[model samples]
Target: MNNAPQPHHHLSSDEIDLFELFHAIWKRKKWLIGCTLFAGLLGVGYAYLAPQVYQVSSVLRPAAINELDALNRSEVYKLPPVDALAKVGARLESYEARLSFFRANPALFEAFQRPGQSLEQSFEAFNKNAINLTFPDPKNVDALNGAIRLEMQYPKGVDGVAILNGFVDYAIKLEREQVSADLKVIVNNRLNEIKGKIDAARANYETDKQSKIARLLEADKLKRAQLEDELSAVRLQMKVERSNRLVELAEAISIAKSIGIKSPTTPSALGAAASRGSSQVMRTEVNNQKIPLYFMGTDVLEAERTALEQRTNDDFTDGRVAEIRKELRMLDVNREVEVLKSRSKEDIFLRDVEPLWAEEARLRGLDIDMSGLKLVTIDRMAQTPLSPIKPFKAIIIGLSLVAGLMLGALIALIGHFVQARRENGPFPMPDRHLPHPQKHTH
Candidate 1:
């Protein structure tokens, strides 16, 4: 039953077979080794020939409380140590601050200059990744004790330590200047506010003084009017009384002449009887009634009426009139109003300005000098590094050797397929038919 022999079927070329592929690669082991050696040699050469890059770093921490005591004690401005450290860090990371430092110190960045590159271009390149700031992670519990690290990556010949330390100093100085300027502005603004208040107080004092004078003058005016009215009334009364007295004296004189009386006399019964007999007793009879005007003789009444008529000023007739005249003269010029109006320095009289002046003086005496202020404490100054950070020799050689092995394997596979195609047509042919072995004769 077709036992002659069946041709063993070989695997198709369209599918991959790991065993055959491994076998092919093992056949070209020398080529893989040689390529690996060549690539490793190239890596070593590059590691030695390439320019080295060094890194210098410094650590910054918050300043001590005593270092910032003066600033806080100023009362005008307060700067905490932690915040000061943060500000210094921010300044260090600033592009403008870096550019300013680069421009101010030309010799420090001389290594950054190269052929065909302008000074600006060199600075730009130098500024681009040369400086790095590393802050402590906030999630860590020990972050409070951690510090900010400033690192600078520089090429072979540059003084990285000097540049880093100088940058730190520059940043601190800038922060100090800014703090001092801010303090000055705050103090000056407060001073101006105090000055304005003083001026307003002075104006208020002047206004108050003027108001007082006006009140005094108005009161004096009203009092003078009342006094003048009283004086006029008194004079009118005196005039009317004088007229009445003159009329009375005429009546009395008529009565005295009709009775043949010529002098002031008292009407007594005995005297009247002696002078005019019983007929005079009727006129001389005295009762509880007041004395009659005719009892006074015509000569005395006529003299009193003449005196009253001739009196021009009745001021001496009543003591009240003299007192009113004196009071009116005093009211003519208000002494208090004159004193208030003549005052040149009115602030001294104001009671509200004492505290304000004291406060102004206190503010003026405050010390705003921040020259000795310390913003940050340098935990570690930048030191020159002993070795370069770039060009990892071991890693470079390892990766190159791996890559060369891969490339050599691919070339070996391609060469094996090409040679197979030439020997056995387009695709690789299966194993050829095998010859049978002859049977042994007994």
Candidate 2:
């Protein structure tokens, strides 16, 4: 025997099922074709119904090579080095610094916020919402504040989606300027603080000096007037005393001369035989007494006048009022200080910071001078067609048709099996063949 169970004398379950499928297709060809058509149409519709989108990429770098030294701080007398330079060490990377600018300075943030029908307009519109800008929520603000992050990786040719490019470049430049402005604000606040202190100190100094000077001047004037009066009176009194002393001395001298008082007996008894024989003879003859009276009264008067003048000079020349004079002199010195105090004005330490503050204050009205930020184009303005840059309509439709055909064939196969089973009646079974034949033989 060939064995193998004689190959079952017919087909197994797989072969039988395959033959059934083959037979069903032949019988229900119309239905199978119809299902295939449906599936093909479905696939065709899907492929063509998808929407198309275009995307553009841009590249930008942070503002570089800013001439920070161009800003002048030379005249500032007391500014700290950092304050003078207005350098916070490139804090533009810190969203916080920029955030503060946006929060504190509306116009500043607004300028950064892209405007008018732009890809970035979503950020700008938020500025109008008072709640958003007024009370910053970092979660909400991070995206808005993110400096323009340009993607320069791909060279999407000149026809690229360049719409968002200019704004982004402009934005980064604005940011650099804004950062510089923020630094300036810091410097300004510091300078203002020093200015305030200097002003207050000056005002206070002026106040104190003025008060003391006025008082000192008044006292000096009063003292000088009083001294003048006293001196005049003293002079008159001195003159009178001098005259009296002179008169008294002159009268005494006159009396002495008239009485011949100078002829007293020679205490050096006959020390010199008196004027020899004449002396003895003349003395006895007429008692000749010659009074030494050459302007004796006038000499006494002159001596009296000299003594009085000496006393007046001594009294007037003494440094008795030195303190008052010194006080007056001090007042005069402080007067100059007061003039400076009154005339002096506060200096603007961060000159450029002012426009920044104003720009920050009035965003729409920004006359911001970005010249100082020293911006350069690391990535020049260039455009490329947006990707899926070239829309291959033909290729897309071709792919669509191929996919549709396959889907259609698969649907047709399943539908054909369903319709064929119904048409062929229930599954076949072997004939009974009047099975009793075996019983009868038995």
Candidate 3:
């Protein structure tokens, strides 16, 4: 007490002992091992007992974007669509359209495919939904036909051959037409997006042209060193290549001449003048230019025409887009002539780009192409189980009981250890921490 300060309160030792824990584990070793092994076996059995699931998948190549981009850039007042929402909407719409077309005709589906077509083929053609299609062979016609019908029996209920054929055909056509119709709104939406992009491009081009018009006129008014330089370069190149160009032109003309015989332009007006002909060389001028059929001699007409031609031209990659664009270009231009060559290089490009004004509309059409939806099978076909997959009461109860037994063994071991040590250690000296018997009684 003199050397150090006396403790205000005494501390008590913890009751837990490691020996008891180890002893308990050893005593119930069989229960612990048996429970673990039982749980593992139960897990394996449950995994295998679960039902198998069946799945189907379809695939397709995505359409090109650059072609649309090029179309957009060529327009007067529009720009290419960079919006993700617009694109996703378009893609979704496209998928919807495909699905609509797929569902349109139940009859067509029946007609398009039958049993024995496939269990699982790598690639199968679908008209609308996932209906398969294969040309029916004559030998297999009866079987094929049976496979598609809702019932194995023909004529549905009644047995009139004429009535049945008519009904079946009518049903199929109705289905197909309905599919197209169902897709109409969505397809139209997607197509509209394409039209929108095209329109955007067109609008931008127009804006650009008008904005640049004043500039072009102003430049034209100036001494035009830049234009002069460009003109000179073109002239120089033309001069160097003139002979080869002429030869090429001649070859082109020769090839053109070889095609479909001209009808002599409403029966040759040469009549009596050529009746007395001496072999003096006859100079013939052949009409070899492709002109828009609808154009009269108007600039607007010409613009429209040029637009169609530009889009249809070889430079555009998407065959569908290219054809439509060219058509649109031709539609915008004035009457059919060599008007294409008359315009400067820049003008040509602009005219080509004008059809892109309808890109938004075209995009709208693409958006409805839901038939392009793809699928993948995560799990193969297995019958769905009607009951719950987990909580095996038998296994759970067995494990719980084993756990309880292990716990009991632990308690017993702990009690045994305490009793054994009880007589060995001297009682700790009571100090400030000693509990009063009076407090315990109170």
Candidate 4:
């Protein structure tokens, strides 16, 4: 009998037999089908439980900055640019003010209310899907197309457009109020600083002026006293000269009487006393009688006396010229003080501060229109969506079907391997060639 040793053909696990794979799969077909159908049912039930959501969206266009409009509008209130609206929108997220606003208007947001839930909780839940702000360029904030997009989602029964509009208006108003308050605070601080500087300047000017005025008044008084002293000395000199002239005149009259001449009593009054011994008398024929004429004082002395009298009457002793000079000097000093006071009142710091004060006032007062500061303009209102955006039945079902098939196939493969190991042998290891040991007959 030819009973020779047969060579063993070892198979690696990598060498998969398509026939064996089909046979294993076929053996677990019912289990795989059952797993698939169960997963699909779970998916269908999940889809049914999920609420349908409707989305409402709108676009905001930036308002053009018209120079004429800015001029015509209140000078203190200016509008913010379109790009600023995106920043404002970003700020609106998670703001406590927005929550308070929602609570205040409970009726408007009745759709957001949940039974036994606090207002804060309800509002937070609603915000999860309620609002979104999108910019044209995500990386660059300034590169805006002047269009800000707003999106809101709500349950199937709620009117998304109406709610979105209400929220938008509320947000815009809140943002504007906050911005105005912030600007008012900044402007007020600046104005206060400027006012303080102006006040200090005025105070310093007044203080300096008072010191200068005191010095000027004291100087003027000293000058007036000196002038009075000089005038009094002149008066004493004139009095002495007058008395000497009288004595000379009397003596001359007595001499004429002693000469046995019929002469006027004061005829020699003008004669020079120092030259009396050499004096010459002149005679003139008048009415056939010789008449003698003589002066009461020397020509030089008489001319000096005449000039002194005229000076006393007009300029020197009359005190009019000195009084005029003092009056003019005082007027000039007073005029200078007035001018300085006026200039101090108009300090440059005050001029710079008043406009800021006006702006602060305008911001504080809510009566003024601050629409110019609005960064966002609703270019298109949000439209009410006729259909639900979420709970996409077709997509959800398709994804679930794929996931179920993959899971069922994986479980089936594992079961097939386990069954094979129990019935025949262990799984073949890859990459190694091992021969089955042949039974040897000695």
Candidate 5:
């Protein structure tokens, strides 16, 4: 006989009582109401205890056309666009920069009531209510403007008006310093470049002048050497010519004596010149006397020799050679340096400083005008805010009521199930001590 237990149609106590869900909630109505009221009271108390924050704010607009035009009329140079100032402000107030700002300005947290808290916590709290810069939505294409609005919460015990003014002052100070530093850099760079040009020009002039002088000196030296060589040759030629003339005069006298010509001039002057040697003969001419051909030739040669010696001496004593040496000695290598040094650096800087001067004045004027606008004009100066922005009372109460009702309902259902399980007998136990039960058959 096949022994198999038939599947029993059954419902366990653990099964969800779908039809009785409403009745279960209705039975626990008192508990749900009690939980809802308690949660609502807690919400109201939180709203009462939260600290209130008050905001101080200001607004800025681009420089108007009239303002810029007025400044232009007064100055030769034009002022920079207003958007530049706006961009700097935006950069200073960006998310990353804001973080640094809070850390830097600890006084922004001086209002906190919590004692013994780390400055780290104070800085964190200040960040929560830190300064903000808002711009028009990018989506509103036509509405986009250069106007910026600044807002920050007032700290306890510190004057809100003073803080707002301080921030504006700091921003303007920052812009001015940046402009000054930029101008200084530009001016310094330009001056350095000019100095470099001057140095280069002076160097080039010196090099060229030195090279020319060197060449001139070399040429002069070569010419002087040549003159010395020519003078030596001239002296040698003069000596040979003097020897030949003496030999010719001696032969002519011998011939004259053989021909029986007797003259006092020939025997006395000519014989004396021949016997004493030509070196001793100083007279260039014999005056007022009838002379022989040999004597005449001797006089002519003496004159020629004297003239050659005078010419050679004159060449060495020439004024033009002295002039060349004088010019070389007086070469002024520092002419350009002296001229350039006469002009000071301040003079040069002032000469080119017109534009930078104008720019600085323009920025200063703009800053002054901005200050007249009450430092960007307060948008909504902080008043003592009577109410806090956080822990919205109405919202908290509503949420708490709903949450309590739901939680209470779940607990009530779970309790109901648990009680039912307790009243019912223990679930059929599977005994590990006995062998597995065969399929039960009637």
Candidate 6:
């Protein structure tokens, strides 16, 4: 009979022995408990030793339409609440703005300093993850509300609330100053434009006035020349009439000397002498012819001729010459042109001046002080948090215990395999199912 140990028919190579596997694990129960306790203690120590981080956040919303009414009415700047919120969001996210805030307030970030890190390096670390900005989703229905959230995370002993509030105020103030500067520039540019128009209008008015004066002066000169010509013609006519009178007197003197008349005689006197002898006979002849010039005595004719030859000034003799001279004196200066040239207030006389001045006054009167302007409304202000946000004790302990249990189980399995290999052969049969080695009775 063959006495070698025979393998059990019920047990197969693929089948695992549950009793033996449990027995092996049970043998190393002390190790599993020790590892679990050690891992739990480590978790507890880490939970207690890590720095506690606190979070503070604030909510901001767009201002109401009425809040921006003054700015819109001024027409200098038209900013809507949505755009204002966007600007605030931009400022909140700017790295430079954050750095500026950090520099401005040194006490708030003093806790971030480390031993070997420079101030700038510490700030860089803080700036990397400390500030968080959240904006409303555009795809959502409430996007028109234009709400934004600002969050700050800092280690223990840091004043995140004050820093956030101060940064918000600073951003708004900076935006207000920028708006004011832009408004001032626009207003000044408009004022300059109005001034230029006013100046151009005044210049045009002055030129027109000068042209009017020149025209008046030219007309005055023409009138004076006409009067002078009339005066000269009248003087020449008087001189020629005087010479004709002299000739007539000389002819009349010769005729009187030949006819032997010695005194001035009228035509009526000659007619009466011829009709004096025929009063009753009534045989008189009617003659319409005037008496000849020789009938006047030479003494009167000679006296008139002497006066004509001696007259030097014809202006005194003729009324027309005196009138012409008076007119020429009147035309020497234009009163209308003088009045225009001597005017002191030329603006009143200018056309389209009222509108320009009115616009200028309106621009000058605009309110550029936007300090009181409401850019954003703080829905919620940041407050000190009650608890820290890091190092969850329960979760850490639970996960560490689970990991330790797994490691202990792997070690027990490895030890069990090595003992089994040493006790039996390299390929050991199932411990429980293998028949005991029968005594070999030969």
TM per candidate: 0.82, 0.43, 0.22, 0.59, 0.49, 0.83
Residues forming the 10-long window of minimal summed lDDT in candidate 2: 127-136
Candidate 2 ranges beyond 4 A from true positions: 1-51, 66-162, 169-369, 372-382, 386-442
For model 1, how does the per-residue alpha-carbon lDDT over 341-404 read when each residue is reduced to its tens digit? Answer: 7888777887577888887888788875577888888999999898999988889888888988
What do the candidate models score in CA lDDT, each in turn?
A: 0.83, 0.45, 0.41, 0.64, 0.56, 0.83
Off by over 4 Å in 3: 1-14, 51-65, 73-442
Candidates sorted on TM-score, descending: 6, 1, 4, 5, 2, 3
TM-score-superior candidate, 1 or 3: 1
lDDT of model 3 at residue 281? 46
Better of 5 and 6 by lDDT: 6
| Candidate 6, lDDT over the whole model | 0.83
Clashing pairs in 6: none
> Per-residue CA lDDT of candidate 2, range 1-442, in tens?
2323221254432244756666655565665566556655655565455443334444333233233333332222222323322222233233444444345434433333444555235333432331111111337644322222233222222222333344344444565666557656755665566566656655765676668667766776687677666656665665676667666666755664664444333323234445454464323323355633323444454465467555644344335445444544554454544554465433333233454444334433333344644443334454554344224455655665566555545555677766656776568455444223222221
lDDT of 1 at 332: 79
TM-score of 6: 0.83
Residue 164 C-alpha lDDT in model 2 = 37
Each candidate: how many clashes? 0, 9, 104, 8, 0, 0
Q: Compute the lDDT of residue 215 as modeled in candidate 6.
A: 88
Global lDDT for candidate 1?
0.83
Write one digit per residue (lDDT tens) for candidate 5, span 1-442.
6756554444543556776876877788877787778777777777666564556677765555554453345433344445444554665465554455445566754674258877657656655756787775557764335566777775345555556656555565555455445544654565566566556655665566567556665666676566556555655665566556556656655655554444434546565665777765544544676556443443454454455444533324345555544544544244444444355542333334455455554544542232232212233444444644555678877887888788778778887767666776557444445444466555
Off by over 4 Å in 6: 1-11, 14-23, 114-119, 139-141, 252-300, 317-319, 429-442
Clashing pairs in 5: none
Query: Order of all candidates by lDDT, from best down to worst?
Result: 1, 6, 4, 5, 2, 3
